[model samples]
Target: MNVTGDDVRSLALSLPETTEQFAWGMPIFKVSGKLFLTLPEGETSMAVRCPILDRDELVLAEPAKFWIAAHEAGNAWVRVYLSALDDREELTAIVTDSWRQAAPRALLDSP
Candidate 1:
């Protein structure tokens, strides 16, 4: 199933304490002022928090769906091709994981 920008926005914003902000002409989602997700490349893709090692592995495992932008290569971020996502559940998982990474420790333990 293909994921749209609306899907990205909804899933990201549904996460605990997530908020949206505009930057670089794109919608970015943050957890307590820390960015966790962003709609980039005409909203066709989304960048999310992911460790460098894991990002590389994901790209290698699914080049069609995962990649690192040249400008973001130095950061712990991975780009996911929305059109190539497996389904809503996968998108939710990705957004949730990214949110968890950016959320504060207190938020993580909170109910």
Candidate 2:
């Protein structure tokens, strides 16, 4: 029941200023030119940016739903398990937050 890369791409496209690109062979989503999330090629996880303090809490609460990429290991970002996200509300919150973090401050301050 793993969600495909297209599913991730579609979700990102629905966000404001989100555009897709390749970063380290992964599908990276950006908002106003800043990266927010990435689904690495041939991998089973997703790289999602989060407030530094929130990383441990999220992973501890749902280990199955979260992990950190080896490269980004121990960083603020966590790799969320796409298959574990069946709850639309929670997913929406995370995706929206990602967009907010990636979006420029001017855009956020604007309207």
The top-ranked prediction according to lDDT is 1
Clashes of 2: 0
Per-residue alpha-carbon lDDT of candidate 2 for residues 1-111, written as tens digits (9 for 90 to 100) = 466667777888998778888777777888988888888746456777897678878878889987666777656688888778866666677777878877888877886
Candidate 2 deviation (Cα RMSD) = 2.0
TM-score leader:
1
Model 2 TM: 0.85
Task: Return the lDDT, model 2, position 88.
Answer: 61
- Misplaced by over 4 Å in model 2 are 41-43
lDDT of 2 at 85: 83
